[model samples]
Target: MTCFGPRQQTAALQQAVPKTRVQTCNSTPVRADGEFVLYWMIAFRRTEWNFSLQRAVEWAVELRKPLVIFEPLRVGYRWASDRFHRFVVDGMADNASRIAAMKNRGVVYFPYVEPERGSGNGLLAALAERACVVVTDDFPSFFLPQMVAATATRLPVKLEQVDANGLLPLRATDRVFTTAFSFRSYLQQELPPHLAQFPQSNPLARIQLPAMKTLPGTITRRWKPVSKELLLGDVAELAAFSIDHSVGVVDQRGGATAARQRLQQFLERRLAHYSETANEPDEEARSGLSPYLHFGHISPHELFHELTSCECWSPARLARKSNGKREGWWGMSTGAETWLDQFVTWRELGYNMASHRDDYERYESLPDWARATLDKHARDRREHVYSLDEFSAASTRDPLWNAAQTQLLREGRIHNYMRMLWGKKILEWTASPRDALDVMIELNNRYALDGRNPNSYSGIFWCLGRYDRPWGPERHIVGTVRYMSSANTARKFSVDGYLSCYGEGTHR
Candidate 1:
């Protein structure tokens, strides 16, 4: 088995860092005499098991400078709400605690939660004024690409953006994949060489630090460190921030600590049954790690490394075809193979698309066949059409659809099986295909903690046939674009169980 623990640094896992994974967003030369190496933390928020964090540590060592991690939670982003803010703050609190524990080693972290709109962004540029270099997470989705480009231009020092979003670097593929089969084929051939090339999951496990003085009182006063009360997981204080509070936080906790705990439990308990029962709405075999992955509290590389280290599968055994098999490659139990497909290939497919295409989230970005089919049925008579507000309230006539939406509203996520049906019903009931897209985006973004991610758009678009192909018996409105039915989906799973768990009265 490949050794990925802190002690064993074999040639396989210690390969030279790939240049494709790192990019210099600014032309500015690195500052020779500066206060510290600034890690402008954004998407990937974890202290350890982070590629971008590892890059920052290397730069700090090379420059003989102390490292200061700057993380911010802004109130002004699209679909910002109490739930989103609370989840982020909880993670930040976890980060604050971990960083405090590392203070003896001279690593410092400061998280800024904006009390008002436009309060947090200026702090990064302000901190950059004294930094030798600015390194950040190179996530290529939503406003991140544009935000990083703009920040790089304005910062006085060198700005390096590192891709820590997935097992495969976003730049690895040049073209957007049309389907999972094609992407998996590319993945099968490409994964061997890169298997041992994971970033240092715990950079601090090896680094020795130089003690540095604290920042000036003026800067600290202007942008104070997050309070212990906030760090203690107080949502009431967070809700007082100038963001929407209607969408409340879920009962679930958020942080690297929480993520690590969840990962451990899933591996030990649910992994064996993962493939056998992951799609069953009535079963509890899920990892529940999506929100953590979405928030960058956990790393996909970390997940991949832990799984690979198990020695559960060998290359010889994995030679079997994964093309159409429910299980892919890896000689491990059906669970492990199925999980690797979901956690790596499917997740990264969306990241790959977002990295290559600016229109990844746009309605017009749907495939030619999908668009033509949707356009062909644009004028088809609709039996039911509901506005976005009605959908949000879960007042629909269909029990199954209402259950899915309420699941999203109450739990901040829907079961994986029901999520597809949720989108399919929305598409069927909306006035037009475009209207369906808009409503799906709005509801997902506002409610789900895992929303506003590359996968979110991928999942939503999949319902509209983005990465899917035509099916038999083209139906109304959807045309050749694939279709799903409540009655049909209900028969496949325990509909009564699902309805009770997430349907009407469950919410009330």
Candidate 2:
């Protein structure tokens, strides 16, 4: 490996970068002599519409070093299985092609799949050893923050993290909001200035590489990438790994290509009818993009910019004023407005909460009011109590409840509207609120493709009254923590239709 001297950039290029987007991880000295700028692509998997990738390119250009994207997946996360592994490998399969194309343009892409447990443990540190500066995604939840923290402790050169996860910068809010209204108000007031600076969505568009065409011989000899055949739909690889095998692969494929296809399908066919049928379990009309968003196959900014501004549409068409209301600002169709709220306010709100609190997922972290109410009703009796096994097997008494759980078991996700009822009922049936929380986390994190996301914690904790208010006429077991009745929920939509789809073979 040889060092490339620090390169100079024009004022225009420097000004294009946003200061708010970058967060310095360590104060270690930036190397004046190192092989290349390294990007450890953990969360944001795509090549385009990625702030982290863009920032890496900027650093590589400014330092006159080739960009090295080192992405490795260890088959040892808590719930690693054929299902999750397949989705990720599918995305990597896409990334492999994208990286191969960039090879001609001086971007060195190394995709590694851990052959066994603990194989990829020291990957980032090894890459950082020879690099000028290491840059990675600033994801706050799951094992990502922990992984980056571990790497930051040992790296000698500078390490930087870019928040490419959400529209709201996690650092902007000092505290988490307890409600959607409050966050939306803060969002409306704060987001205007930052919106003007978008990420270099297509990092490959402008080809500016270091003079060197080849990577460090040491890197090539020691860290050769796995075969492309292994990157694509290789479920058989899971058998060699030490993780759960019962939970199976999902039918929906994973990758940037698949994500874009899903997004286009959503915009073209479903966006028009979204507002009306989004919550209806029978219709299956929502964007169907959460899995992609959670895994970083796609980005919120990409989807948001696309939704707000297309050839036929613009945010200016938004007739509704930013009055701190949930909908209307986009002055677009009902579907777009409804989705924008979910995409920006709600999704980012969860991201904001997780980024600030280390114990964001804990039961004790629930709002004071919620904790009080649940404590008040802690001794209340339950008419039905089921173990975690019953829930996982989808053997609950309620047909709707069983159907939702079955959907999770089979499809790796539950429909959004049914998902709420799924949590609320689990609250009702579990012997204790603490037990309910544990159950939700296990079932979700183990099965749902989008389970490890901030939204997953948000939805789970929301069931126990996080980001919510006490309702009138406090009910038993749940008390004032907002009760949802299964019967009432069943009547809200086509219950029979839901039962017909996920309820097959399993008894109600």
Candidate 3:
């Protein structure tokens, strides 16, 4: 490997990551004598549209070293289950195939699946010892932030984390907007430049570096790369691992392949009706891309590109002023505008909060008014109180709530509108507001494929009025915070097919 001086390394890094999207986790310098540049694929797992991978490629080319992509799955993380494991391994399988096809590109993809608790410990440090530098994903929510911070301090080489979470960089603004309207206003003013600076659509194709032929024997012998058989085999094999097999895999496959397919399906068949029918429980207007986004199998930039290309949209089409209105800002069709609101404003709102506040997921993180209102009605009599066990078992007296829970249990997801009613009902049925929050978090993170993500926290917190204003006519158990009812939900939308599809009897 060719050695690069500090100034050369710095210049390469600057070219690789934008100032707004890059962060040095530790003070260490890149190792000039090291064998390869390691791309630790944490949040952004796909080969395409990834800033972290692009950064690694840049470092590798600059230093004349091969690139090593390490994507690992630990069995010890909270809520690790057959469902998440299978979904992630499916992606690993896809990545393995993709990288194999690019063998001439001088990249090595290593996917490691921990067979038991704590089995994969120290693997990253081992890889870092031989790497010129480590480039990884910069994600704010869940265990990723802490994990990266801890790993950076222990590694021998410099560690750089790149923000590829969304269209707007995580560090773009320090202020956390309280509502979607406010976030939309901020984005309308600040997001245009970011729209123009997307990660390379196919970064691997452009990567030109020496191929890493082998891994160190010590690291390879102990923490072996996951087998092709395991990745492509029946998900039933996941039971052998020390993870929760109770949360089984859903019907949907995971990875960039499936994510793109779902995106195309939504664009061709459902996007036009998205504005009108997205809230209807029986309609297939919702884009089923949350799981893919959560797992980093797809990039928001890629989705944005596809959408913009379809509409012939560009930064020049953006509104001249920020009025906090959702539809006009994008200068796209009504459906595209509506979808962009959810995709950019609402989804990135969670990222904004998580990036700014360490307590984003805590019950204490609720807005002052929401907490005050919820606390005021804490002791008010509840019509019914259900234990976590009963809730998890989908034995609630409310058929609609049971259906939602059943859907979550069976499919790892719920209808968009039904999920709101689901959380609100949980709040209504639980003993206290805090208890309600606890139940929602437990149920959601345990089953939903998209759980433990910033967006997931946003949705869960929204139930307790995190990003909402107080409603009028204070009510018992919910107080001034918004209230939802099964009867009213029934009146608002036809859930007959939803009920039949995920009714209590269908629960396993």
Candidate 4:
């Protein structure tokens, strides 16, 4: 196995600094300064196995100063919703509870209610009065990139980001991946050496500082309180918002406990069929851990540790290999291997583009051929153009697309394959390729549990050929961009079953 030496160094630094993984600025906090640490909880919300959080812990321990975590959620951020808010509120509740255990280790939890709170001013900045540095989640795409860019310039203290989403931070990949195969090849060559060791936290035992004060009694009492105004809001008001509300706030649970349980369930039951059924929309075979992953409720390191801890691989044993070359252990099922590839290699590919490329979220950021094809097809005849409002309302005539939208509405997510088709249809039915891309992003970010994610951005771009190649003769609507039809999808998969489950012919 080719050693990902630099990656190993990055991992070590991440563990040592704790904030390195999530820090966007890439500078290490100056520990000798005796400044307290600020854990700017953004993308990665969980407290455990968080490189950013750990980095704060490191600073606290070294400087004998307090550590404070600030998590602010602003309203009107595109698809901000009750569902998303509830998930985050629950996570804040979780953080409050967990941080209580750390005592004087100093942790603060802030859950902002947007407009009412007014973009919630800087508790982090105030905390930085004595802060050694500020560390936040290192997300490439999404609104976060803009947030961090602005933050890096504004923060008086040094700003760093630690990546806790993908198994390997997207920046670890040297070049933008053109396809899954190329990305997969690189991951296969790199994962073994670096994936073996996980980041370890700086134990609390050494930091026997004063007990940290808990959240103010008022904040604790008001935690996740019901919103009477929201309950009273008109249906049209609710509908106008992009955020998903179908999965009631109660259904959208968050926090580390829920994230961990979800991961376990996937590995124990669903993983066995991952290879065979993950693509079957009706199966709902995916791990369902994505939202947690997206929210940083569970760490990638924690997930990998669980996988490696299973000594007796469920359903079999790995065959012993005598070859000098390092190969996968025998007895590992295809399902296990396949899912790992998605989790580590393919998913990381999205991160790679997001981190390295400025236009990662734009149509122009797609591969050269993809961009050319989309430009060529920009003026092609679109059979049925729909406005963003029409698409958001699920008013499109195509039942498959409607069904997919319904699934997204009710479940707070869509299945993986259906998700692909969802974006493709947006591309096909919109007046121009760019319009399709915009609609795809708007809709996906608004409803999907995994919306507003790097993957979602990459998925939308993929419909325009980000990680794919040219195929066949250029066609209208899609140009050289890949074409996917409801008919073709129907032929390949059982769309009827999915539609039936959500109730066909019902335009609600």
Candidate 5:
């Protein structure tokens, strides 16, 4: 293989990953004599529509080396559980099958599931020792940013982190948006240029490079790839892993395969009613794609493409005005516009904040007015206070809240509308505003599949007035933070069926 100079390498990488989406993590030079290109697949775990993988493939082709994709699951991370592990492993299973089917693709898929705490440590470092260059997902939220940063400093070869998190790159703008309206307006103006920059929908399909038949013996001997049975979703195999078994796996399988199917089902069956019924507790109009999106099993670009194609829409249909008002920007149908608001505006708002603000997940990161209003009402007496245990057990007196919690515990998700009520009730019942925040974080991150994500934090914090404004006629415990009650929710929407579905005695 001919070794390229630093300038040539930089030019090639720029062509592969757009300047807006790529971040050079370290100053280390690429190793000219290295064996392969390593892709540390952390956030964007799927094989398709992934900028990280696309970048890795481009590097492999440029260097005339095979591509090694390392997707690892660590047991020591917070909220490591049977449910999350099973979901991710299912995606690994799908990736393994997909790679196997693509014979001679020159891509090696390595799925590592840490059997115990700290067992998977140093795996990336060991793999990087022989790699020409390392590429990874540039995820801003949770522990990924820190983890990548720490690893970047120790690696001998250059590392590139690609932003595949959303349609708008995380580094596209440095502004941290405080409200959906402002963010929506910014997006309407800024997002059009990025729409044309989608990652390859199937980067692996035409990939051709040197095939890597084996890993270094030291690497394979210590960190063996997960067994075939484990990837096959064997129940007995799952039980043997050391994680939080109490949070049992849900029925929904994870991975790009299931994510695409869910997208199709939403478009075929529920999209027409989405504008009117999405907020209703009883309707199955919501997309239910959050878990998949959170795990990077699917790409927002794929969803947007399918939706626009269904509507016979294009960039030319975009509204000329840059005003942030939600409905008209896309120039699509009412339902499509409504869904895009949540998907692009609201969802990317969280990503924007997470990328710019170090304290995005902290209560202190709330807007000044929100923090002040919450602090003012923090000491106000509560009519009902529940311990975290009581809340976790779904032992609350409010049946609707309990039902939502039950749904979270059993199915790993809550209806979109009910989740708001659930959080507001916690604010109303907990001893203090901070306690409510803590409890919401714990419960949501513990059980919900979408928990521990930027959007999840956005939702949880919204209950304490993060993206919301103070309402008139401030209440006792909630202050000016917008308030919600089960009685009022039931009045506004039919909840009888929702209640019955997740009501007490439904599950242990």
Candidate 6:
């Protein structure tokens, strides 16, 4: 069928864009008769700017079949917790609300948790039995890719995956780079033409499905409820779930509403200072939207749409010179463009690595230079070799590292820059590079709200020498993994001042 209006952003065209583009593979399933369309909502969570959702809707209408959006939350996966569970349930709640309001066009079924063990189950098999086609979110790294591979192989029907996370999908890149410069250059060239038109979501016109008799409870209520009176008690109980229960979920909350509010607040209050303060751990410089992005609560496409409409970066238009009454701003402000660059370029760069590289989560994925340099100093005597216990307890002698750890422990996240420094210090304090990598992953995946994401893995890999170059003469602990010393951070910024804000046990 000829789909029209604005051109649909396909994964192929998206990949052709230079920057982080979201592209649809040729394998993307089409909606047809005698088959229902299934949108396996594994990644992109929101209803807006969602190409995958658009694809699912288009196919559903084409086939005149109802669409099913299935999001299964398995409990025993790595780093599963009440915190993450609550965040996911929040998004599920949002999905239910929106889909329900859409009549019977779409149905979101979470199954109250995955019945299988890991991401390696054949859940899609049953869903796709009579499916016109099955479409899933194309994520590069983590268990998502592996799961996709396994599911695709087992499916009896047509299977397609759509790239919706990055502004430009990593498939667009000709090759991976050791730094962001190459990726940035590519994206800058392709963004204008590709990102010019935002793809519109056409919900299924009319389809009959089961009625929404039961409304999913709110996240706060469903997850055992965290009240002002029970905050301490809830935290204490939640802490018992894991070894490092020190980290607690914040009131920032999760889901579409929270994500939208955070974005609005960032655009209004923080966008002006994003470039300057993003690195400062103490300042709320970031939009704090990564978790939402990771969970698919907010569609990157929607964000791109909103960003393009903003005064700072709206597309230029023809000028009417009669009385100088009508014209496009010759020079659009770069704020939105700058943020978009970060969103698509840098963010997807990480996803590209995670998606394509098998060893993304493993230490061996470090660049050749990083590995070589690290091995050169493999036997370098460590100043302090604390056990994971000591490290986990924040008993390190370095007050700076301790403070960073405490912040992550209390807030479930850390300042973006401080996180890098935090990982580097762990590398230095541990006995071996492998051990350091292990420790970093363990602590991060366990605590940070944004942990276990592509960015999280990419950040850890960066500390262990991915997407970076070896610097200077061989150093002791860091090897080639890009040495980031506390002294260097102190010189680079006010380390003492930064740490003072997230001092030990300081939770607001």
Winner by lDDT: 5
Ten-residue stretch with the least lDDT total in model 5: 1-10
Model 6 bad stretches (over 4 Å): 1-35, 105-111, 115-124, 201-248, 312-338, 479-481, 495-501, 505-508
Against the hidden true structure, what lDDT does model 5 obtain?
Answer: 0.88
List per-candidate RMSD values in Å.
Answer: 2.0, 5.5, 5.2, 5.9, 5.2, 7.5
* Number of colliding residue pairs in model 5: 0
Off by over 4 Å in 3: 1-15
lDDT of each: 0.83, 0.81, 0.87, 0.67, 0.88, 0.65
TM-scores for every candidate against the unseen true structure = 0.96, 0.93, 0.96, 0.83, 0.96, 0.80
lDDT of 3 by residue, 1-508 (tens): 2122222323433444677898999999999999899999988989988888888888888899988899999999999999999899989998999989977557888899999998898899889989999999999988999999988888899999999999899888879899988888888889877765777766777567876677878888999999767888587678789999889888889998999999999988888888998898854688889999999999998888788777766566778998999789788889999998898889999999999999998999999999999999899988899999999999989899999999999899988899999999999899998999989999999999999999888999999998899898999888888999999998997878788888856545
lDDT of 5 by residue, 61-91 (tens): 8899999999999988998999999899999
lDDT of 3: 0.87
Stretches of candidate 4 exceeding 4 Å from the true structure: 1-35, 101-119, 201-207, 214-250, 311-331, 505-508
Q: Residue 88's C-alpha lDDT in candidate 2?
A: 84
Locate the minimum summed-lDDT window of 10 residues in model 1. Answer: 3-12
- What is candidate 1's lDDT per residue for 428-464, written digit by digit as tens? 8999999999999999989999999999999999999
Per-residue lDDT for 1-508 in model 6, tens only?
2222223434333322122433443453443553457788787776666767767766665666666777666656677776776676677666666766776634544433442344324445655765778877777756777677777766766777777766565565556655776656655555555554444443333545433333235421343222232222244434334322334456657789889888888878877666667676545577888888888888776666555445433334312222211112123344554575567767877876776767778877787778777777778898888888887777899888888887776667777777888888888888778898899989988877878887888788788778777676666667545678788887876776666676665555
Candidate 2 off by > 4 Å: 1-15, 211-224, 311-321, 504-508
Put the candidates in lDDT order, highest first.
5, 3, 1, 2, 4, 6
The RMSD (Cα, Å) of candidate 6 is 7.5
Give the winner by TM-score: 4 or 6. Answer: 4
